[model samples]
Target chain A: MNRCAVIGIGQTRHAAKRDDVSLAGLVREAALRALADAGLGFSDIDAVVIGKAPDTFEGVMMPELYLADALGAVGKPMMRVHTAGSVGGSTAIVAAHLVQAGVHKRVLTVAFEKQSESEAMWALSPKFPFQPPLLAGAGGYFAPLVRSYIRRSGAPPEVGIKVSVKDRKNALKNPYAHLLLPDISDEVVEKSPMLWDPIRYLETCPSSDGAAAMVLAAEDSLGGVTNPAWVLASEVRSEPTMFAGRDQVNPRAGRDCAKALYAGAGITEPRRQIDVAEVYVPFSWFEPMWMENLGFAPENEGWRLTLDGATSMTGDLPINPSGGVLSTNPIGASGMIRFAEAAMQVRGTAGAHQVDGAKIAMGHAYGGASQFFAMWLVGRDKP
Target chain B: MGEREIAIVSFAEVIVERSDRDDCELLLPVLKRALGDVGLTQQDIGFTVSGSSDFLGGRPFAFVMATDVLGAWPPIRESHVEMDGAFALYEAWVRLQHGDLDTALVFAFGRPSQGPLHDVMSLQLDPYYMAPLRPDALSLGALAARAALDAGLTSEDELARIAGERRGVPTSTSEPYLREPLRAHATPTLRDGAAAIVLAAGDGARALSKRPAWIRGLDHRIEPHSLGARSLTRSVSTEQAARGAGALGFGADVAELHARFAHEEPLLSRALELPASTRVNPSGGALAQDPVMVTGLCRLGHAARAVHEGAARAIAHATSGPCLQQNLVCTLEAR
Candidate 1:
């Protein structure tokens, strides 16, 4: 692949209702910021690739066409990618491919969701298929998995509350975070209503309306930026939702994606080597579950670290220092937010929320019964 | 030709007519054929990508069911786009440039019989502007056709001729006048289809096929959706894209175009401006099988096939979106 570097990253202020701007306006907010960061204009972008969770989530079918002008993709190649929750990461991977493939010098990638305009529950309502309809709402789907993790790993239920409290507290530093609960505590999370067994309202990600944008440029396009997050490695994986003997818990797809990401980036010990991680844990328990899946910790022992405070914001390895999905969950953009946040940490551009001395960062996201997985490892140095 | 060569090592298709089974049922066959054509299984294809839309199926994550047929049991590198199979193929091509994956599988499927085609397409128009009028694809083409007529780019006779030549079969025949200005024969037939293209790198191409359609140059461009701003008669986007791809030459052979309407044939012909004698749409093109999202990929596959099959020296052009709003020109030649 050609040398590709992320010169600019931008995001809209995450919120519950952004009625002030239309969907196009929501995306432009982030795109313009990213362009300015790259020290370039829209004219410098050779192509655009967009990603979002579902069309029903925004009530726009193939929204990229409507978004072409706002993104300055007019008279340029534009492609739309959809991979459930992992779509944001997948969208950036496609943009990176433009530079990596030696096709375009620079590509603009954006992912967003105006959840205020549509109901995620209604959009996820499964019909016309033989399988059982999604009933857990957003949290319900992951609750059983969380329960399985607890039962199989012998993890105490309090571990989830710890994650929720830690992420919400971290949100205080991120002004763009939608749910900045500086006052949130473990007791507050535990006191919240349990929407799903083993999962409380506070332990789950919020449905936010926001957008994230990143400008991926061929190495030659980089100019004024002193620190650039050269993309080290990227990978995406998928598996059948249901098969004869598929393991939804500890998904093979997530494991494969992480394995590829680490191997590509030449990371031998993710736990010791990875400085900061921004994993997509829409539900709190997933912080440990994905830690195990990504090989950051053993399968059954990941929760032990969470309980031991080894995975805290100031612990051995910081996780989701930007409040993660637990802070601002824009469903579609949530995945890319994780990816861009990783880039920001490496570029030393993550405002007050920056993880101090962070060098190697890994970003992760999963969608659709945890079957879709996209991840990338970014470092301070070009690999 | 570029430094790294891209090739269509294998292609598979499933014509999803009013069949007894569902769209998913149709996918297994096409996918198997595409993979088997290169003597490879799902595992042999290093990366997987797909394209589809939820509006057509009236359900979110419609493409999720496809993984069942793909047998992603061990999990595989995969992604999806909501555009067309052609764009997905482009994504695969880009991924292959990393020298990570030698072969990639690309596919797209939709059931036109399942949804109201015009209304679903209306969902693609400018929401604040044209969509309110419920401007279906035919009307959009009508506007473009009227513009072309006013511009004297081509005559109605040229469109009628294109309609007659694009459809050679009987059951799927085209008549004059579906939406005044766009004869029924002139409009590309609305059909349901599933298309898959297996792309390979230079070394992979050498290993897969004796003759591979070396993808010399592939480029795609989109014009703004605003009807008032864009020139409907000519695809300036297409011209710009062909120029960017450096695919402008008097192609001595042919150009397999994705012109959905009869009027579009002339407009795209003017935009890409293929040689006057170039054989266009010999496979009846989209005029007989206008499978929206997959049609553009089909045009690309057909052009590549023309080269690998030793039928044409070079082929250029593919037109997409409503009223030729977006276009792609991929110059192909056999190495």
Candidate 2:
């Protein structure tokens, strides 16, 4: 693969509702910021790739086509990617390839979701003759998984609340993160309205109207960048939605993506080498669940890390320093936010939320009954 | 950087014909054959990627059921693109180039029958501008054809000849005009089909087949979605795709095109720089078959099969999106 690096990253100020702008306008804000961050204009991009969940969520079909002009995709190679919840991560992977394949340099990738514009729950309505309606948002789907993780791993309940408080508090440092709760407390998290039994309201991610963008380039395109996160490695994996005795709580696909990513980045000890990480944890408990899945901590002891404050921004290794999807989730863009946040950490451009002395970071995302996974490791040093 | 060879170790595709299979059933078997032909199972694949569109199927996440039949046990690495499978294949190819995985399975499905496809597809245009006008896909193609006609790029008679001889249906007034400038014969028939191809790297390539259709170059580009912004008579994107695919400076043995319209054949051919002697659409091309999203990939596969079977040496060309709004070109050779 051709050498590639993340020279610029931008994200919209996530909110419950952004009625001031249309969906296209919401995305262009982020794209323009990213291009500005790279000291380039939209015309500098050679291609554009969009990532979003099902078209039903937004009532738009293949929006990259309709959005061509706003993203400066005129006469360019434009594509749209969808993979249930993991679309944002996968969308970035596709854009990275444009540069990696030597087909285009300085490719722009963006992912967005405007859930406030429509009722996503009804949009996620059960398809005829498949799974019956669980009437569960992502939190409902993962609460059982979180319960299973708690039971299988024997993690205490407080671990989840702690993460919830931690992320909301971290959101204060992020101007673009939705649900800014600077004074977030465990009591506030525990007392919030509970949508699902095990998953408290604060523990669950918000349905945000937001977008994220990144400018990926070949190594040569990085001349003026103050700091850039080189693509140490990227990997994506998937497994059957339901087979005999599938592991939905801590899926093997997530594990495989982690192992492959770590291997490619040449990091044998993830916990020791990775200084920061931004993981897709739609539910707070997923921080521990994915920590185990991503090999950042031992399977059963991942909760202890959170309990010990080992996963906090001030911890030895901070995770989700940008408040995480649990704080701001636009579904499609949530995964890319993780990827971009990780890139930001390594690039030393994380602003107020920067992980001090961070040289290596990892981004992880999963979707679809825990069947799809996309992960990447970025480093300050070029690999 | 170093050369990392990739191969189409296994391949599968349903014929570009009207199918009675349900959306899931119609798509599942094509993927099953692709994995089976390579003597591999879903578990053998490290990554999975798919291509498809919801508009074509009248339901969103239309490609989701593919995971059920693909045996996504224990969860697998997966992604999907809302485009043709050819681009999905390109994404898989890039994954392999990064040396993270050696083998991958790429698949795509579309059933044009599931909805009022042309009317639904018009939604892909700018909603505020084009959708307000209700510019159906037929009218768009007709608009492009009219531009060609006005430019003397082709004639209605020539278009009919290409449609009749190659497409098996020539333009006729009897069929009634769906759009004013487009004749019934020149427009491609609405179709339903699925396709899949297996990609492998290096030794995995050699192990898959005696004659692997090694992809020398592959790429795709898109013109703007607006009709007013582009010169519909010629495809600058197709030419760029061909140039990036490294297929033509001079010539090739064959050019299997995916043009759905009669005039589009000449339009795309001139863009790709196909020699006059080069055999074009020997297998009757998209004129004989087109399964919407699957047609572009089927064309590439047709040319690849031709090369694999010793029917051609080097093959090039592809068509996708509205009025060839997007184009892909790949050179394949027996190795």
Candidate 3:
């Protein structure tokens, strides 16, 4: 298979409402930036792959069809991917596959969600026929999983609070982060309103409108760029939403996907080998939950890493230096942002949040009751 | 087109005017039958992907519930697309080209019968300019038909004949126009359905089926979104995709096109430059049963089946967006 690299990356300033631009303009903002970053134009792209959480999020069915002209996809191959929250990461992987499969030299992938267009809670909690109402929204569904993780891991309540504070503090350094809480502290997070049991309002990700994009090209297509983030490995795994003997907190799909990714990247020790990671931690507790799932820490021991400041910027394995989903979530774009931020770290372009001398990084995302997972490893050197 | 060779080893589908079964219920049997045809189970598949729209059922993440049908106990490498199943197949084909995976499962399901499909399809238009106007799918199709008629590319009588041929009925131009230039018969009969296909590469394909429909070339292209920006009388995207897929000169014994409207058939035929000898829509095409997301994939299935049933070569076409703004062309062969 041909090798692929992330030659360009761009994202819009995430906000609660980006009323300044239409959906077309919103995506173009990032796509144009990515094109500029790559020192190319729309004409340079061989294909376009877009992903969003759901059509209902914007009440626009298959928005990619209409955004084709806006993204300069006319007379070009354009695909739309939707695997729930992991869609953005999967979209990037799919674009990379186009290069890896020798189908295209350069591909533009974009993921976005205009949450201001509709209330995500109502959209996600729709009443289905012959089924119990899911009125609790995403937070309520995940709160129990957080509780289970806390109960099983015996992690202190302060661990979740630390993650929220650390990530929010990191958001201050990110210019495009939606929530830049410069004064974020453990006391503030602990005193916040508790929306769901064992989950405070500050611990959950905010609904923001944003878009993320990346230009993936075959290794040979890198024009003059000398420091492109080489895609080392990418994998996606899925399991049934609910079944007997299923573990929701530490999903098997996430573990299986991470195993394949690490195996492909030849990383037997993720914690020591990888310089940084941008994992999907919408809920602050998911940090430890996913840490264990990703093998960054042993079972029931992930909380120790977080409490010991192992996930902070100055730590050995810095996670989500771009503030992560909790600090700047646009739902669909959140995953791609993680992937893009990881690429930025290895490329040495992550401005204030840059992990110094970072050579290898990992990006991860999971969705749909944690049954779907997507992960990729990127490094400074070509694999 | 990559280093790895891929072919459709098995295909299965179920179409109905309307069904009480949910998405999972509609897809489980089809998935089982598709895997059974190749003497393989879910565990044997290396990769899995599906395509469906959340707007079809007005439920977010509707495709998630369908995973229960796969019984993915050990967790499988999987992905999904919001486009038609044909695109999902394209993704699967790309995955197989990675040279690690040997087989993949692709499926798609839709229930346009659950809502007013015409109006729901309008939401696919530009939100700022087109969707607010709420132009139904049939009306958009009629506008294209009108453009074709005005351009002298086709006539009302010819459209009636095309529709008649697909529906297996006699043509009569005296019918009332459903949307001026389009009669009721010229429109497709929407249905609810699901489809599944198993693809294997190289030795795996040879081991699975007696005669696999080798995919010689596959490509998809899209045109401008706005109808005013495009020449509605012709499908530029289809022509481009056909050329990219090497279907321009490839001789095919049979061709299956996802032409929901009668006028689209001739327009696509001309775009692909199919000779008169190429039998079009031998399985009656979408006019017989247009199942939104599954129609395009069913075209692929029927085309592949023709090759499996002794056809020397076949070309399958799948389309998306209004007025054929996007198109995928795949050329399959028995060799």
TM-score of chain B of 3: 0.98
Write out fnat for all predictions, comma-separated.
0.78, 0.64, 0.92
State the TM-score of the second chain for every model.
0.94, 0.92, 0.98
DockQ-based class of model 2: medium
User: lDDT of candidate 3?
Assistant: 0.92
List model 1 lDDT by residue over A132-222, tens digit each: 4578466767788788888899988799999998888888989899997867988889899988888888998888999999999888878
Q: Which candidate is the best by DockQ?
A: 3
Best by TM-score: 3
Task: Give the per-residue lDDT digits (tens) of candidate 1, residues B197-250.
Answer: 888888779789888877777788888878787888778988887786666774
Cα lDDT of model 3 by residue, A212-315, tens digit: 99999997899877889999999999989877678998998899999999999999999999999999999999999999999999999999989999999999
- Which of 2 and 3 is the better model by DockQ? 3
Ranking according to TM-score, highest score first = 3, 1, 2
* lDDT preference between candidates 1 and 2, better one: 1
lDDT of predicted model 2: 0.81
**Model 2, runs deviating above 4 Å:** A101-103, A132-134, B1-10, B16-20, B43-47, B73-76, B99-102, B169-175, B201-207, B314-316
lDDT of 3 by residue, B160-219 (tens): 888898989886889888888799999989999999999999988999999999999999
**Please, what is the whole-model Cα lDDT of each candidate in the order they appear?**
0.83, 0.81, 0.92
